[model samples]
Target: MRIGTMLGDVLRSLFSRTATRQYPVERAQPPTQLRGKLYYDPEQCTGCSLCVEDCPAYAIELITIDKTKKQFALRYHVDRCTFCGQCVESCRFKCIQLASNEWELASLDKAAFTNLYQRAENDASNVEKVAATDVETPDKE
Candidate 1:
C-alpha cells in the first residue's frame, strides 16, 4: 500500500461517524416479537406442567404449594433457558410469556439465575425455605 493512500484512508475513517451505538447509556428499544426472559403468573396458571414439559432446556418447574387453593410456585432456571418461547407456546392458560424488554439477564451471582415465583399471599417462610434448598449453585472448587 502507498503512504498517500494509507493516510487518505486513515483520515476518512477518523472523519466518519462511529458505527456502533453506546449500548449501556443509550439503549435501543427491543422489538415486540423478540423473545426474552420467561415470566410466569401463578394466578392464571392451573398448576399444569405443560410449560415444564414443553421446555427443551428443562428450565421451568411448576410446583404445587396447595391443590385446593390452586397455589403454585414456579422455579425458573435462567441460565438453562434457551429463549425458545416453548413455555409461552405450551401454556394454555396464558400464564407464561417472554418479556421483550427483559433481555439483559446477565448476572455475576449464580443464585440470581434461579428464580422462584410464588403468590404474595402465600407463606413467605415456606417459599424461602424451598428456594434455599432447591437453588443449585455450581461448586467453585
Candidate 2:
C-alpha cells in the first residue's frame, strides 16, 4: 500500500503545476474590488477632511490652504496605515480610490510602506504657506 501511494505522489508531482507564484518575476493581478492602495484626486476633493476624520488607522493627514478654497492643500501619510477602506467610504466627493498597486509595498525602510496621498494641485505646485493676512493681527498700539 505504501509503495502504491509513493508512486501516485511521484506521478502527481510530475503532472501538477507549481502552486506558488514567482512574486516579482510573475505577479498576480489584484481583483477589481480589492482595496490595495488609496489614492486621492485633488480636483475632485472637496477638502472636507471627512476622509481624515474617518480613517480608523490614523494614516491620513490634512494640510489646509488659507484661501477661500477651504480645501486641503497637501495631504499624505502612510505611517500607521492599516489599509482599511473606511476613509474611501467616508469620502462623499468620490475623490478617494483604491489603487491597483498591490505588490510594490514591501520596503526595508519602515517609511516606505506609507502610501502618500496627495491632491492634483499638490502634484503640479508646491504647498503654499499661509500668509500673514490670514493670521489674527494684534490690536493697534
Candidate 3:
C-alpha cells in the first residue's frame, strides 16, 4: 500500500512485454485433434440414425431421401452443437467428422447455423423444401 511500492509496480508493468498474443492478426495453428465444425459424407452413410441418437445436444438430424437408393441428407444445427465429437464416435461408416481447421464458425445470420449436406444428384428443390420446413427456429424474445 506504500506510494513508492505502488509507483515501482506501475513502472514495471508499463515497461514489460504483453502477455497475450494478437489473435485475429497473428493466428496460431489449431491442434490436430481439435473438434471444430461437423462434416458429413452421405455417400458412405447407410441412413443410420446412430449419430442423431448419440448427440447429447440434438444437433444432428438424418433425413431419408430414398430408401431403395440409400440417398440421405443430414441437417446439422451448429448453434445447438456442443462440439463434443459424439456424432463422430457413433457413426459406424466414418461418414462424420469434425474439421480441425474450420473452427471459425461465427455468423450474424441465424440461417447460417443450419447446414444441409446432400448428394449433387438429389433433387435440390425437394431437399430445400424439406430443410426449410424442418429446421427449428429459436423462439422469439
- Winning candidate number (TM-score): 1
The C-alpha RMSD of each candidate to the native structure, in angstroms, is: 4.9, 7.5, 4.4
lDDT of each: 0.81, 0.62, 0.86
In terms of lDDT, the poorest run of 10 residues in model 1 is 132-141
Which of the two, 1 or 2, has more TM-score? 1
- In each prediction, how many residue pairs overlap at the backbone (N, C-alpha, C within less than 3 A)? 0, 0, 0
Taking all chains together, each candidate's TM-score versus the true structure is: 0.85, 0.71, 0.84
**Global lDDT for candidate 1?**
0.81
- Please report the candidate that would top lDDT against the real structure: 3
Better of 2 and 3 by lDDT: 3
Q: Give a tens-digit lDDT track for model 2, residues 25-103.
A: 9988777777666677766666676777777666666555533665454344555667788878898888878776553
Candidate order, lDDT descending: 3, 1, 2
Task: Tell me the tens digit of each residue's lDDT in model 1 across 58-100.
Answer: 7876677776887788889899999998888888999988999
What pairs collide in candidate 1?
A: none
Estimate, for each residue in 46-90, the C-alpha lDDT of model 3 and write its tens digit.
Answer: 976788878888798877777699888998999999999988998
